[model samples]
Target: MKKYCFGVDVGGTTVKVGLFTVEGQLLDKWEIITRTENNGENILFDICESLEAKLDEKSIDLDEVKGIGIGLPGPVLDDGTVLQCVNLGWGKFNVSEKMSEMFHGIEVKAGNDANVAALGEAWKGGGKNFDDIVMVTLGTGVGGGVILEGKILTGHNGAAGEIGHMHVEDGEELNCNCGGCGCLEQYASATGVVRLANRYIAKNSESTKMTEFGEDITAKDVFDLAKEGDKGAVAVVEQMSTYLGKAMASIATVVNPQAFIIGGGVSKAGQYLIDAIADVYVKYAFPACREAKIALAELGNDAGIYGAAALIV
Candidate 1:
């Protein structure tokens, strides 16, 4: 007898859905525009309808499907309750129960999107072969997910891997969008890189491509210039790595994963980024844990879908 599963990654713009065999082979995947109007009321219905259509198109029996796994853009409790999804316009609610009811009692498991992505990486990406993994996603904002011994540490409120909010600096009183000061996100995210670059530019009018890009500069541009040995961009990347390395070092003390898998858009900078971060991590890490590895995530956008699908298994 063959088995199948469905994975859903609910995002602000679109909901990614994947169909996979129970053995972790992805059969098909598609996307649907997330209708977030009216507090995301249509999101769940949209997912179920999409899955139903896929099943009909594939001529697959509903009984052969084990369950549906979903990764939401918010904190999800073990009971499938979502505390809130700011991007999806959702308030506190039980996502798993509603999804299960929508799918006619099919088992539904839910988790935070970043956490789910971490699980995907652990299973098949950079963290493969390592049961304990910590994933840091450096996109528009920094996100983190922790998987220890093949299990996600969701914490009491499902906020265990929220590494972006870690307070790294003490004198930064301007406050972050999360209403905190000196957060790791403020210094290590894509936007954060631009901020660091501008400060460096202001301090020294160095001849580099980063300064030429003006305020429109991006993290990629900085890294690109750094790869060419540009002094200013190298400084910016070094600074960003400093904060991220320190944060990961602190995380290593508790989560103590075998590897720190770096993902997200910023990670596109490639090996130099990993080298920079690893250099600083080694300096701040506990003496006994200095050997923990740092590597880039293999799956790009598909990690969340794979992870959400894994939730059912």
Candidate 2:
């Protein structure tokens, strides 16, 4: 009987790999630099090589491994076909098919990185107590994933949780990376916080601590200043929280998840951030969904690997 499995989280700069027992206990983990040269053609081969090396080091036979699960930084169809991963310089292709071939028919599963992370959180992280949840990642961009009854809700064409692109503003002058204006990501992401802070600083004539950093301000700086009672910083946080809370309330009317799991870099602001969003969420949420709990993600960076492993577990 198979006793082990592997998980891989592919990113632009590196690949995170983990070895886990079939029961979902992680045994070891490591990382490898991502060589994106040649349109990332070597990426898969490199991951395979790393996996093989890991097996050898652990003295485990190929027959003892059940399968491998992978998470990629782009939309992935239910059938494991990656529509297109621009950051990886990859075009449409079957990730499961190619990896299975390389492993001589071993089972392989693939999913969008954000979705997989949500699955991981449901399985063992912040949302472990609930079977239904929405995970929002607030990093360079805002990403989201939904889980229902412990399974990922991969929508048609595998784009169910692109929450960042939800139109949140009426007249945004700047465009989001997705090419839309006034997206939730534009005001809720870490970069988005900086943008808001800058705009607030530009218009407010009041003295504040944010100006101490001048042009080198950051999301953390804004949150820190807010915690320290800086009016300008507090205003920026309030604006960001308003957009996020409103978007989440709209989502609740549709999915009505048991909980909303907040993750990614900006979430590091901790309970203050959660409280801010939760306060706004209740104002707009449907009466039936008003009790949905908002909580912080527990897995941190390791969430991706854990989620990938869950694909096969």
TM-score versus the correct structure, for each prediction:
0.98, 0.98
lDDT of 1 by residue, 8-57 (tens): 89899999999999888899999999999998889899889999999999
Those runs of model 2 whose alpha carbons end farther than 4 Å from true positions after fitting are none
Judge candidate 1 against the unseen true structure and give its global Cα lDDT, from 0 to 1.
Answer: 0.92
Candidate 2: residue pairs that collide: none
Most lDDT-accurate candidate: 2
Please estimate how well model 2 matches the true structure, expressed as its whole-model Cα lDDT: 0.94
Clashes of 2: 0
Among all windows of 10 consecutive residues in model 2, the one with the lowest summed lDDT is: 204-213
lDDT of 1 at 138: 97
